[model samples]
Structure formats: structure tokens, C-alpha cells
Target: MEKSKIWVFVSVLCAMFVLVACAPGSGGSPTPTPLPPVSSYEKSIFTVEEGPIVEEKQLMGEIVPSRQEELFFRASGFVTRVSVKQGDVVKKGTVLAEMQVDDLLNQLQQARIDLEVAQANLAKDKAQREYDIQKATAEVTIWKMRVADAQLDYDRAVGIQKEKALLNLNIAKENLALAEAALKLVQENTNPYMEQAVKRSQLAVERLEGLLAERQIVAPFDCVVLRAIIRPGQQVDAFFVVFVVGDPSELIVRSPYDFDLASKMTDKIEVNLYFDSKDEKGYTVSYLPNFLPVTTNKEATTTRSSGDYFYFSLPKEIQQQDLKVGRTVFLKVILGRKEKALLLPPSAIREYKGLRFVIVQDGEKRRRVEVNEIGLKGTDKWEIVADLKPGDKVVGP
Candidate 1:
């Protein structure tokens, strides 16, 4: 029995030691559970290539005339006549439209008649003055002749005859003096007021004529009428546009100036233009920096500048029938180009905190290589200047 008790006590003591060893914080430190192996993250990859890269800019523009004008009436009135229609070829000074001018015409005619009458009256007055002077001069000559005759008679007569001849000579002398005085008065006559009246009538006629002109719309140059906004009996305000005229012989394409694109453009750069209405492929042409004059439209006249446009000429093969003002056009311009350059897909480039880099794959490892400079960026690929070579693999962002 004691031997059994000793065996039981030893078994109990061994169990207590095993419990103490298994309890939390009993040992110096426990071994951590091993983590599962991390799987590698895979991403889309691209290979760098050596090829020519070109960067281009696309623009939407319109076909416009190199020279154009908007015709309007300077004075307000009811429209009485429309002399031209759209697409009518006209010469300079061709009347495009007319406004209510019956009253102005009457006034102009009356003023012209008044001017003629004033001129005639001035001429008549001058003629009358000249006639009076001539008559007085004739009278003076007659009296002097009579005086000479009387003196001769006196030389041939005795005392009584001599006294009568002297009396006659004195009478003739007095008459001649009176005639001379009359002639002087007539010669001194000057009617400046009459000339002034004629001038005033002429000015009135000119003023009326000017007002009549303002009531009509006239072409400023030989051009095709693109639009006529007035019709018979239509009332319009002053400075309202009544026609749109342009020289169709010389056509040009114009676009709103893009400062950013302008800065990148060069004289040697070629432009491709596509007519939207015709759905034609395009014409390769050159571009020029131009200043389009501001339109007479009140809205544009206030805020637009001449430098807000770029001009391009159409190809010679383009027919006038295929073009129209305000027609939409598409333009593609080559902004930059490079030959035999290191090219990479734009997706492969990564940016972080202002740092541009690419994940370059070498064997089984991947590392980031900083992109020092980028050049001639294209739509799909970009030219990257980095520590990379052709056939190098890069991971896409």
C-alpha cells in the first residue's frame, strides 16, 4: 500500500510540473506561428521600343474669307427695297438694300432746287451791278464828248456865244462828275450775303443727300453677298447689319487662336485640314499667324481682338463650290517629332510626390527607375529619357 501511495504521489508531482510549463508566461519566450509565404503581385507589363514618335494637336476650325465685310444701314428706317440676295455677285458701291427715303428724297430735291435758285439770284444781282456800272461809264463818255463840242463852239463864237458855250460846258462837266460818282458807287457794290445764302443752300442739299445715303446699304467691295437680312417694308435700327459680303476668290481657314498651341507651333510644321461638310479626307497645308479684323457686329466690336485668329490658305485644287463661309473644318497639326527614340506606353509611367518613374523588370525582380526627362509625348506612347535600353520590360501602373 505505501509503495502504491508513493507511485501516485510521483505521478501527481509530474502532472503539476507539466501544467506549470504549459501555463501562459511560464517560459522565457514562445515561438511565433510561422506566416504563410507572401505571393508575388503580378501586373501588366510592356516592353520599351526604339522608334519614331510624333506628337500632334487636333483643332476644330472654320472656312472664312480672307476679306469680308458686314453691311449695315447707318440710319434707322423702314426697308423699302432689297436689291440683292444671298449668293449675288456685286461690285463696289452696288446698292444691296434701301430704306424708307421718300421724305429724304423730297427734302434733297427741294434743297437742290433752292441751291440753284440762290445761285441764279446771286448771278442776277452781279449782272445788274455790272450793267449799272456800264451805263454810268457810257454816260460819262457822252458828257465828256459834249463838253469838248461846247468848248469848240465857244472858241469859234464872240462874247454872247462864248458865254452860252461856257455855261453849257460847265453843265456837261457837272453831269460827267455825277456819272463818275455813280459808276464808282456801282463798282463798289459787293453782295457777300448773296454768296453766303448760296453756300448755305448747297450745305443743306449735301446734308440731305448724306442722310439719303445713310438710308441705303451699299457694298464696300466687289464681293458675293452671303446674306441679306432685310426685306421690303421691314423696319430696322441704325447700324443694323443688312448684308454679309465677302470675296470668294480668296478663301482662308480661320480658327480661334490657342496660345498654348501657338507657342508650340513652328513655321515648318505642316497642317492637315478636313472639310466637315464634304466629309473629305483632308488637305496638307501650311499655317500662318494672322490677325483677323474684328467684325462690325456690336458684340464682337466691343470685346474681340484682331489677334484672336489663325489663318490658313486652302489648296489650289479645292474648288469654290466645295467651300462656304462658316463651314466647319478639322485640323491636325504636328506639335513635335523624334527619330529613333526610346518610346514607352503612357500607362507605364508612374508619378509619386512629383517624382516620375517606371517599374522596370529585370529577370525575376522589379525596381523603379526615375524618368529624368520626357520628350515628344504622343497619344499612345511617350518618349522617356531614363537609364533604360530597348527591349527592357516595364510594368504598367
Candidate 2:
């Protein structure tokens, strides 16, 4: 039985040895444990370089003429004549429309007649005043002579005759004093009430003249007549816009921007204007030009809570192109630009402890080099200023 148990143990040891031989690490040199796939990681890299780059911003806006205005009237009246029509090119001070001035003319005529009548009445009043003054002077002279005569009689007579004469002379002296006062009052005989009436009549005539002058709508600048809203015999109220004029020589794009954008923008900004007329596939590129902001009147803008007026001149680059008064345009404003700058993909840059760095790759090795200054070239790129020379391979962050 012991010999049988030994044989069984030998058999089991042989089976264990065979199992160990089929295992993965049971070879002579141990098959050299395949090294965890070389511990590799993929990283993206970028080559630093200097080139021209523009930071462009796309904005949609409409086209407008540089000098455009709507002709308006101050007083309500009927349109008597339409001197010009749509698409009529007119010069500055050209009469475009005329309002009915018949009423104004009649009123002016009445004012003139009233003024003439007032002048006649004033002449008659002056004549009457002069006659009163001359008559009062003569009466005062007669009364003074009578006083002298009474004084002579009083001096010459004696007793009762002298008393009677003295009484008569006293009455005459009172009459003389009254006549002198009347003469003094009539000496300065210009009636203040009549003078005021004459002035009022004159002002009426002047005011009517001014109103009559405003009866015609004239062009303020050399422009094309874009529209004439009023026809012959059409009634319009005060400040009603009757004509639309556009000076297309210096075309522009007028758009409204809030105070925030206007405050932060540079004075001269570059723009790309896309023409609205496209042949179905859509426009690929557009005209480029620099624009200046239109000035806003602070006093006129009572509230900045709403939008403010802003405009951009139609790029001089497009001056040779055919355009209309209300042509549609799109603007691509260049917010920033860098000429010959080292631009790198944002992914190639790494941030550590508030410092911006780029990882440079040398074959299979990479190291982070701190950058002195970095600016945003675009949404997905950065303008880096560092010791890294151009064409340096930058690795992924």
C-alpha cells in the first residue's frame, strides 16, 4: 500500500509540471513580460510661426447714403404743386414742392391794407394834435394879455373902481393859469396807444412774409429725389415729411448701436461689406473698407437706455460699384489685427499657476516653456511672444 501511494504522488507531480510548462511565463528566458505597451500617450502639436492675421467680427447692417434727409414742413397746408417726381436729380436749393399760399397771400394783403389805414389815421391824429396845440397856445396868449390888462386897471383905479378891476383881474389870472396848463399838456402830443397799433400792424406784415416764404419745400443739398409723398392738393400737417432726398455720392451704412458697444469701439474700424445682390449660391467674399463712427448729440439723446445712431461710410473701395439709394449690405467689422505675428492654436498652450506656457516637442520628448505675453488672435488661436523661435514644434496641452 505504501508503494502504491508513492506512485500516485509521482503521477500528480508530473501533471503539475506539465500544467506549469503550458503557462505563459513558464519558458526558459520567461518570454520577457511584454512591457505594458511602452506607456505611450498621443499629444497634439503646433509649429510656431509669424504671419499676417486679422481678427474679424461679422455684423449685419443696412446700406444708406451719406447725406440723406426728409424734407418737412412747419405749418399745416395743402400741397398746391409738385415740381419734381421720383428719381429726379436736383441741386441744392431746388424747389421740390409748393404748398398753397393763397390764404397767406390774402392775409398778407389785408395786413398791408390795415397798415396803410393805420398810417393815414396816424397822419390825421398828428394833424389834430398839432391844431389843438396851436389853438391852446393862442388861447393862453389871450388870457395872459387879459391878466396884464387887469393888473393895469387895478393899478390905475382908486377905491371901488380899483376893487372891481382887481376882482376881474383875479378871474382872468385863473383862466390864464388853466390855459397854460392845457398848452403844456398838448405840447408833447405823440399818442402811445396809436404808436403801439402801428408796430403791431408792422409785425403782422413781417410774420406773414415769413410764413409765405416757407410755403415752398426746397432741397437742402444736392440729392436725388427718392420719393415725393405729397401730390397736388394733398393736405399735410406741421413737420410732415413730404420728400426724401439722398446724396448718393458719399454712400454709407447707418446702423444703431447701444451705448456699450459704441463706447468700447475704436474711432476708425475696418469693415467688409457684402452686397445683398447674390446669384443664389451666396456671396463668398465682400468689399473691405475702414469706417468712422457718426457723432451723437448728447443733449438730443434724452435717454441712452435705447439704441443710439451710428453710421459707416460705404467703403471707398466700392465707390466704382453700382449702387442704389437703399441697397442692402452686410458688414464684417475687424475688431483687431496683428501683422506678422506668431500665432498658435489654443490647444498647444497650457496654463499652470496663473502662467501661460506652450509645450514644445523634441522628437518624443516635450517640455513646457513659459511665455512672456500672450494675446488672443482669435477664438481658437493665440498670439504668443516668447523665447520660442518661429517654426518651433508646439505640443498639445
Candidate 3:
């Protein structure tokens, strides 16, 4: 029995030894552990650098003609010919366009005929006035002769003592007085009539003169024709804008700005503009020009709040080539620049309740640093107003 018990104990000891060989050891050259998995998000370490920091402001604006004018026709007529075209430069009184004055000519001719009739009527009035004067003179002579004859008959009858001849002579004197009174009335009325006819003729001539002035069209100042709205022989109304002429030298740029940005920007602020052309030119603030209020789409914007925005005017840069009329552009206004600023990647800084913090890694330990005035230098980079020591490891997720 003792021998059998010894054999069983030996077999169990062998099994215990096999189990010990399969189990892992706690110390003394333990198995190497695997490192934790790395995160998929992109990250960067922040380091201190010296120099001025340039803040690139991103804004949207438009290219507009600095000078624009709409040429309007004040008189109604058929357009006879358009002498100029779009993009043509013209001077003052240069016939940019001509109109058919045939209708106006006809009207003027009719007015002239009316004036001639008035003159003829005036001449007839003058002739009648002369005839009235002659008739008045002849009546006065007849009256004098009758008076003399009556006097002679009255004296003879008085001397002969005849009542019948004396009565006839008295009646003749009274009739001569009545004839003189009628002649005076015609002289006064006829001169007034003749004067009125002369005034009517003068007024008719003045009306025709005004019509002739309307038939001629002339430009008021030197400008370029921006648009040609009419062709030859096209009937146009007086209210229609025919040619759009504007001063090219005094051009201004019209751009819509964000309402919020407009407040931040002063009317005195200038900007650097980049054009699509090979040469990116710039312009400065010369004039505020005009302000226009407009509404924006809520869904179309990502940065601006919904409300009215101001459309600002900018000075123009004239060129020989036809400039882009309606195109969006980027602008950078110089607000301020800081030299020898401490900069770090924007990812390195974290914010909490308006306080900016940066996680610093030092030999397996993490600490937080507070900073102020964290200006953005570039994409994913920032400028801090605190001391960012060089060679520091920045931590972020």
C-alpha cells in the first residue's frame, strides 16, 4: 500500500511541474507588453518661435465698375443712327447717337405755317388800320366842308330872314359832329387789334424755335459708352435710357460687406486686393462713396448673422484690358502687426470659459498652461501673448 501511494504522489508532482512551466512569470525577465494603439486624428506639437506674426484676414468682396452712367433720352423720336458702341470713348458734344427729326421737322413746319398765317393776319390788320386812318381823315375833311357850307347857308338865310334854310344848316352841323365821333372810335379799336395780331405772330415763332431745339441731341460731358440699347430706326420713348455713358477715370468699386464686419471696419480703413489676373494689384481707401443696405440668405452663410449688410464702395484701378465687372475677390485689411511674437499650433491651445489653456507633456506628466490674446497666425497656427518656451512637447487628442 505504501509503494502504491508513493507512485500516485510522484504522478501528481509531475503534473504540478508541467502546469508551472505553462504559467506566466510575475518578475525576472517578464514578457514584453504591447504599446497602446495610436489615435487616428491628426495632431501637432507646439514650440516657441521668434518674429512678427502676420494675421491673414479672409473676406469676400466684388469687382465693380468705378464709373457707371445710364444715358437717358429726354425727347421722344425715332433713333436714326448709333454712332458709337459699347466700350467706346466719346467726348462732350460728340454725337454718340442721332435721331430721326422728320416728325419734329413736320411739327416745326406746321408751326411755321401757323406763324405765317399769324403774320398775314397781322399785315391785314395793319392794312385795315391804315384804311381806317385814311377814312377818318376823309371823314374829318367832309365834316369841315359841311360845317363851312352850313355856316355859309346859315349866314345867307339869317340875312334873308328865311327860317327853313337856317334849320337845314343847323342839322348839317350836328351830323358832321356824329361822323367825327365814329372815326375816333375806329382809330382806337383798330390799332389795338393790329398790336394783338403782331403779338400772336411773335409767340408762334417762339414755339417753333423751342421745337427745333428739341430735335438736336448732344452729350453733356466726356464719357465712355457702357451700353448701346438702341439700333438705328428703333422708335424710342423719351423716358427710355438709350446709351449708358460714364466717366472711366472716376471709377468706384461696389462691394457688399458683412454687417458685422462693416461695423468693425472704419470708413478710413484701406485694403489689399488680389485679382485673378496674373498681376495681383491693390487699392487704397480714397472714398467711402455710398452705403447700401441689403438682406442676405440665412442658409447661404456660415460666418455671418442674418440681417442687413452694407455694400461699400471702393476706388477703381483702371486698365486697358476689359476688367472683370462682377467677380468675387479676397481682401486683407491691416489692423495691427506684432513682431517677435510667441507662436504655436492652434491645436495645441484649448479654451475654457474665455480662458485659453495649453496641455504640456513633460516626461509622462501632463500640465495645463494659461495664455492670453491667442491671435491666429495661419491655418492651424496661433500667436500667444505668453511665454511659450522652446522644445516643449504639446499634448492634444
Index of the highest-lDDT prediction: 1
What is candidate 1's lDDT per residue for 94-158, written digit by digit as tens?
A: 87888878888999989999999999999999999889989989988998898888888878888
Candidate 2 deviant stretches above 4 angstroms: 1-71, 75-78, 82-96, 141-149, 152-168, 177-237, 242-261, 266-390, 394-397
Name the regions of candidate 3 deviating beyond 4 angstroms. Answer: 1-43, 56-68, 71-85, 91-105, 112-220, 227-244, 252-260, 273-332, 347-357, 368-373, 376-380, 385-392
What TM-score quantifies how close candidate 1 is to the native fold?
Answer: 0.63
TM-score of each: 0.63, 0.44, 0.46
lDDT of 3 by residue, 269-337 (tens): 656655543345665543252442111223222223223333445544545353454456556666556
**How many clashes would you count in candidate 1?**
0
For every candidate in turn, the CA RMSD to the true structure comes to 14.4, 17.3, 14.8
Candidate 2 vs candidate 3: which has greater TM-score?
3
Counting clashing residue pairs in each candidate, in order, gives 0, 1, 6
As a whole number from 0 to 100, the lDDT of residue 285 in candidate 2 is 31
Model 3: how far residue 299 lies from native, Å: 35
Could you tell me which residue pairs clash in candidate 1?
none
